[model samples]
Target: MIWLLLLLSAILGAIAFVAGRRLATRRAVGQSAHSRPGYHGAYAMIWALAPALLVVIVLLVFGGPVKNTMMESGSPAAVSALEPFEREAFLADAERVAAGAEPLQIWEGELAPALRSEGARAHRIESTISGAGVLAVVLLGLLGGLIALSRLRPNLRARNRVEGWIFGLLFACAAVAIITTIGIIASLAWDSFRFFQAVPIAEFLFGTQWSPQIAIRADQVGSSGAFGAVPLFAGTFLIMLIAMAVAAPIGLMSAIYLSEYAGSLTRAVVKPVLEVLAGVPTVVYGFFAALTVGPTLRVAFNDLGALLAGGPLDGIGQYLMLVQNQMALTAGGVMGIMLIPFVSSLSDDILNAVPQSLRDGSYAMGATQSETIARVLMPAALPGVAGALLLAVSRAIGETMIVTMAAGLAANLTLNPLDTVTTVTVQIVTLLTGDQEFDSAKTLSAFGLGLTLFAATLVLNIVAQRIVKAYREQYD
Candidate 1:
């Protein structure tokens, strides 16, 4: 019904716009107007639609509450005698009975006939109110259109007014974005404060242990939880390092080749093919890591370990024997594959944006293509490239699905890529999964992890911005 009202309002506004244009055109047949016919039409349309829409929105928002109040006031003495909560439930049943649906809870006695009577009365009142609201909207819209049409003259500044409105709208959108970011940060900080009160901030930030389990009863085994987050941070850092190590060179090289070396046809074909990797869901990459890469790595490492077990390098072999299917190496390598398109696409755009004159000048100086690209192009595009890599690192650090699937959730404080490990994001998910009491340290710990992650990402962004600004200034 609301959508129908809006549609009718739009049609009425359009008709008014056409009528306003005709009026302005007839007036202009005698003398030149200050603005175009379209501007006069738009001015009329805005006047006609804006107030009518605003009124309709208000009516729609408040209509239900008003209807409920009227129904409760008209409700029978028996119905009103019920408790407040029970009265609400009884009204719900009455509404159902009025609508001809079977009442789920309310059945039997004088309640049934009384509810039916009240429900029918409420429905009739709602219909009457709705009809009046629509009539009021139409009248207001017509009044606004008539006023705007009468005011339209040779000197009216409709175009300027319209442009100002548009500018204000755009500014409002930007303000909304800024406000939303502040809201998110404020929420995280508040919950993190609550969490810190329960667990020491020093222990969370600096302790090496990563256990988060808090037993409800002292008799429970392994319930003495440790909240040291160092291991999770270390694991996160190690995986991000491995992912970047794989992504940076390959993605950058691919971007360079696509932009500088590949022919038009090859660039068109190869760029999209590489970008297709980006569209492939992370869960698919997770599956690839878990089912294919993880197993392959484990078997290869185990075989290599067995082959070297009798040799002088026995200790290294023994270490290799402990390599598992799900480990940091598997997750990081797969995650790197997922990040390639982000790096390649951003780097390609940045490299392409470099002034053609710069490359021409470098070539004119008797520098070879390789030398020109290595020294001039790379330096000029370094800032954008740095920004892209920073984004990728942030992405890598926050990834949960690939880490959860490819890397086992053992919060081991080790640097070895072959051993199972977990990231802060993975731990955060684990800590909050399923039914949880928010007051418990176990659940609140997720907020702590999230706040820490947000802080770390913010710091990285700030540092990257400074570096990019420096390089960009030098190049410019």
Candidate 2:
């Protein structure tokens, strides 16, 4: 029914548009017009559509609540005497029965007959209200169109009015984005504050241990949860460091080759191939890390350990035998592979954006192609490159699936790439998974981790902006 109403409204809007254009044409024939026929038509269409759409929205928003209110008012005395939760559940079940869906068998009261009668009444009321709403929309739309047509004189600045509306809409969209970011930060901070009340901020930040298992019952063992997040932070940084180590040099080198040295055909082919890595799902990378890279590294390292044990490093070799499938190296190396496209694409664009005149001047100064690229173009694009690296680091920090699958869930503080570790994001996911009470410190700690991650990323962005600004000013 709503869709049918929308179809009719669209037809009316089209008719109003044509009528408005004809009216504008008549006015132009008689006198000089302020706006074109098309502008007048657009103005009429806006008048015809906006009010009717708003009425439909309002009716849809209020319709269910109003119908529910009617049901409650007409409900049987026995149904009304039930608890609030029970009554709500009974009404929901009654609604399902009325709609011929599976009936909930929870309600066993003597109010079945009353409920059936109320459901019938509710259905009639809903249909009547919907029909009235649709009629109001159509009538109001026609009225708006007629009024707009009446106002369509040679002097009416319909174009300016329409443009003003469009500008307002654009501003509203921008405001929504800003407001949403602010809302997210505010929510995280509020919950983080609640978490801090349960766990001291100092301990969470500086303590070495990180065990977030909380016991619900007093008799439960191993419930002594620790909220120290230092290990998670350490693991996050270790993996990020390793990822950047792999990504930065390789990505920058690839960018340099593609932007400066590679032939046109080579650049065209290779750039897209590099970017395809970015399009591949992170879960696929996680699978590769866990199933392929992790095992490969373990075997390689184990062999190296055995060789060393036969040599002078027997003590270190014994420890190296403990190296397992899932470790920081496995996760970081794969994540770096995942991040190559981000660095390469952004760096390639930045390097290419450098003026050709700079390269020409370098050549004039008798610099070789390699020397000019290394000393001139690269230095010029350093700020942008730095920003790209920072973004990649941020990406690495927030990654959960790859780390969870390949880096193992142990929140070890060690910097060893061979050691199993976990990140803040992984821990956040772990804490929030499964059925849990939000009021507990364990669940609330996810918000704290979120807030910390937000702050770290915010800091990275601020620093990157400053660096970019400084370098940009130098080049300008």
- Which candidate achieves the best TM-score against the true structure? 2
Local distance difference test, each candidate:
0.88, 0.89
Per the 3 Å backbone cut-off, how many clashing residue pairs does candidate 2 have?
Answer: 0
Residue-level lDDT of model 1, residues 71-98, one tens digit each, is: 8898888889889998898888777776
Colliding residue pairs in candidate 1: none
lDDT value for model 2: 0.89
| Stretches > 4 Å off in candidate 1 | 59-133, 216-225, 473-476
lDDT of 2 at 355: 90
**TM-score per candidate, chains pooled:** 0.88, 0.91
lDDT of 2 at 182: 95
For candidate 2, the C-alpha RMSD (Å) to the true structure equals 2.7
